[model samples]
Target: MSLSYENYLALEKYIESFEDKRGSLIIILHKAQEIFGYIPEEVQEFIGECIDLPKEKISEIVNFYSFFSTEPKGKYEIMVCLGVKCKKKGGYAILKDLEQELQIKDGEVTKDGTFRLKSVNCLGACGSAPVVVIGSTLITEADTEKIKKILHEFEK
Candidate 1:
């Protein structure tokens, strides 16, 4: 997607707000992502120029973090926890069910762009094992049937 003039202006304003500009690359990138939805090539290049860092370095940081997305994500991001507690509580089964029902594997966005499926290490809610996070809502003690109902809520 083409970067709008207003977005570039906003990013520039944010960069100029910082005096030191040291140890702010991640923050800048986060702001850029917030502005652009995802850090496209143009945004990356713009950040590189603003921070005087190589695009490769910026790209590396972006790629290393699961929170950062190079591509636009779905409106609803579904994160299934696969940590030990969750796995023991049938997290993998839940993930497989979602993949089958949505016809999209992990790290994939559905064709309708309504949902993005991802498997995370943990959601830090072990007591609520087998949790599935949809956007900011947490589905504790998640099961296949419960997941279907929750997905329908979003589909509507």
Candidate 2:
């Protein structure tokens, strides 16, 4: 989606607020994401012009960080923990089930934009291996049936 002109103005003002601050590029990028939902190439270029940094450098930073997204995200971002413990506990199976249900693979959003599925390395909740995170709510000891029920709640 194209960002509104007003949103671009907001981002410019935000960047100007941190012009003199050291180590503020990442911070600015975060704010830009908040304003634009995702940092597309155009946003990256705009940020580059605002900060006088090359777009390549900004792109590298965005790419290095998994938190920054270049594409629009669904309202519910479903992250399936693929840490060693979770993986052993059937994490891949859970991911596959979500893909089948949502009809989208990892890092993809469903057609209706309700959900996005992603497989992350760890969520730091090994005690509850096989965890699934939807927004801020964590579903521990997650199984397909349980997840299906939770997804249904969002569908309604």
Candidate 3:
């Protein structure tokens, strides 16, 4: 992992923010993610060292929380809603189409590192039904063609 000195400094500063080790793990992990996108095993090990905790504790917290991702995410995260409402309204086809178009499975970053495909339970917009959220933009009724168009807008 070999984090940069700046990142190391940032992590140290975050570590100092909380006096109680057990209470601050989540906050420290959140800052770690902010500094380093997603937390990898190496980062978790370093965090464990900082908190005087074992890697298993950190891994346990990361795995239990959906907000924490062990894998790397691309610059753009494409999430297709698979909630009860969206799924019933053709969400599966939309998700499958995204997987095919992106050439990657759910929760995987693309080879080019431009996009990551993911399935979400809900986006809080069931009225839109079949929603596809790319970055911060939410598209309603996202068919394959519409998904293509939306992705095009974010291409590097």
Candidate 4:
């Protein structure tokens, strides 16, 4: 679902707060995701309009970033790390356990709208290689039991 023009305009005002020298695009995109729940193509276009950049340029930025998602996400999105370090550290096993428990594949949302499972490259937490990020919160060294507890919290 897309926000109305008025709401998008309001988001523009909100995005302005994130404009600074350091990684402004990523910050704005995060804010947009906070507002819209997902970074759809329209949101990218709106971001471009707000930042006075072309849609193509914004699309490029979106494509370049693995953190940004163009599709709708569940209320609690579960991001599993599958980077080299993470994979070698049992991250994939944790993800497999979660997929079996949730009965959903990677990149798919459950029918109940509680969770969406996604495999991400890295969380920059190589020390905590088997990391699972629920929404914006990171859970390092998460096992199946820990993941279950986390999902229970979201269900409530």
Candidate 5:
């Protein structure tokens, strides 16, 4: 679906806020995600027209980056870091536990829309390998027990 009128206008307002600034496109893109939750094809096209950047370039940024999502997300985003370090340290087991606990598979949001779980490339916490980040919180040492604890906290 396309963006609502207020959402489109909010993006336009973000564009105006950065009219005189350099690197406005990136800022606009960020605001778009914040306003719309996820940047879909149509929203990227609208952003392109607003900033004079091509649709391909917009898509490239969103697609290449792990932080951005092309689809909608639940209120709480559960990102399991699957980088080499995280993997070797038992990240998969943690992910498996999470999937079973939440009753959702990879790249799927929970039925109640309370959580969305997805694998991420890296979260730059190699020192604390096997990471699971929930929203803004970085959880180090992602194990089945720890993951269970984490899920319990969110259930409240």
Candidate 6:
């Protein structure tokens, strides 16, 4: 499938709003990701065409940031923190439990495509160690049971 008509319109308008800006590449990438859910290769090509930049350059920007997802993510992307603080607070245990429950390796989406699990360096919420962010919601003080409950929320 292709991007919907409304998404195309939004892309055009967003591009125009930042046509001549000096340091707005990161912002542009965010807007693109919001419009397309994830920054697929084809959307990167369209962004390059709209801004008159090379596709590889757009690819570089996407690769430069960990926040941007290159492929299509599931309905829920669980971001578990693996920073120093988190590791000290059993983050690895939480991650291992999630891996087994979801039956998929880290960074891989489940078979039903309802959830995708990924690990990040830090969410800057060290005080709330062992944190996991589901979509835009952050869950701190997490453990195996907490993670299992959170994952159930994404279930039908």
| Segments of candidate 5 deviating more than 4 angstroms | 17-23, 64-67, 79-94, 111-113, 120-146
lDDT of 1: 0.89
List model 6 lDDT by residue over 24-104, tens digit each. Answer: 767878887887768888888887888778889989889889989787677898988999999999998888888999998
**10 residues in a row with least lDDT, candidate 1:** 18-27
Off by over 4 Å in 3: 1-28, 63-66
lDDT of 2: 0.91
RMSD, candidate 5, Å: 4.1
| Cα lDDT of model 2 by residue, 1-156, tens digit | 349999999988888787463379989999999998899999999998888888999999999999999998988999999999999999999999999989999999888878889999999999999999987789999999999999998888
Residues 82-131 of candidate 5 have per-residue lDDT tens digits of: 99999999888788888998899999988877799999899999999999
Worst lDDT run of 10 residues, candidate 5, spans 19-28
For model 5, what is the alpha-carbon lDDT of residue 138?
Answer: 86
Q: What's the lDDT for all of these models?
A: 0.89, 0.91, 0.88, 0.83, 0.84, 0.84
lDDT of 4 at 60: 83
- Model 6 has an lDDT value of 0.84
TM-score of each model, paired residue for residue:
0.69, 0.73, 0.73, 0.59, 0.65, 0.63
Indicate the residue-level lDDT of 109 in model 4: 82
Candidate 3 has an lDDT of: 0.88
**What is the number of backbone collisions in each predicted candidate, taken in the order shown?**
0, 0, 0, 0, 0, 0
The alpha-carbon lDDT assigned to residue 99 of candidate 5 equals: 93
Cα distance off (Å), candidate 4, residue 53 = 16
